[model samples]
Target: MQGEWTGELVGPDVWVSCRELIPAGSVFAFLAEHRAALSPAETFADMYPSRNGRPSMPPQVMAAAVIL
Candidate 1:
């Protein structure tokens, strides 16, 4: 089933969960910061269907997942 990307606040414990794995100088850190600033739900509202099935992942999340 398609799942919506609910931009819920990730808990503090999970913040930096991947910090050790990603290099400090990588572009991922920059993208992560920009991702937080964007409102993906509102930005891709029109692209989702209203009924009959589950919603698709938010566009921003999908983009980041693929690129980062």
Candidate 2:
């Protein structure tokens, strides 16, 4: 069943952030900077179910995965 996006952890807190690894001028960095501004998650929020048995992947995460 479709569910709300809750998000998942890929690694520990000590792990280096993606922003640190990606160069500032790179496309990834640009996307990262504009990710929230663009509000992909909020834009697509209504596409997913709000209530269900299990939480779904975050809309922003899914959008990033598709873009990357």
Candidate 3:
């Protein structure tokens, strides 16, 4: 099962607030700004066939980690 970013919008935006901490125009910065737009759902849904077990890391996080 893949974990979704549930109920995150209601809380503090730690990622957005830390933009200055990441180097501008770098992969980290790019991902921090556009991870959701880059990592689409259809692109990775096939990897987790069953949505029953413990959820896996969010696709965007995995994508950013891979790029880094």
Candidate 4:
């Protein structure tokens, strides 16, 4: 994958894609799993754009933000 790729850890050798987790609805379960791994203020920071007027959110967050 050259661009943004979403996947879940099913096993040491398996990275189940988000589509595999929930084949129907647009549920962002993967973010929920890694939210805790993110540092303090990271969640809010992820929600909002950059203060310097630069593009807000990381590439991954930007992609997911569209769903929200």
Query: Pick by TM-score: which candidate is best?
Result: 3
The lDDT values for all models are: 0.62, 0.61, 0.74, 0.42
- In model 2, which regions exceed 4 Å deviation? 1-9, 12-21
Using lDDT as the measure, the top candidate is: 3
Model 4 per-residue lDDT tens digits across residues 1-68: 11222444335522233446554433455544443354333445545553554443344544444543
**Which candidate would rank higher by lDDT, 1 or 4?**
1
lDDT of 2 at 52: 58
Number of backbone collisions per candidate: 0, 0, 0, 0
Alpha-carbon RMSD of each model: 4.1, 3.7, 3.2, 11.3
Q: Model 3 misses residue 20 by how many Å? A: 2.8
Expressed as tens digits, the lDDT of each residue in 4-42 for candidate 3 is 755455656657787678889897777767867788666
**Candidate 1 or 3, higher TM-score?**
3
**Which residue runs of candidate 4 sit more than 4 Å off their true CA positions?**
1-27, 41-68
lDDT of 1: 0.62
TM-scores, all candidates, are 0.53, 0.55, 0.58, 0.20
Superposition TM-score, candidate 3 onto the true structure: 0.58
lDDT of 2 by residue, 10-31 (tens): 6642223555777778887777
Worst 10 residues of 4 by lDDT: 1-10
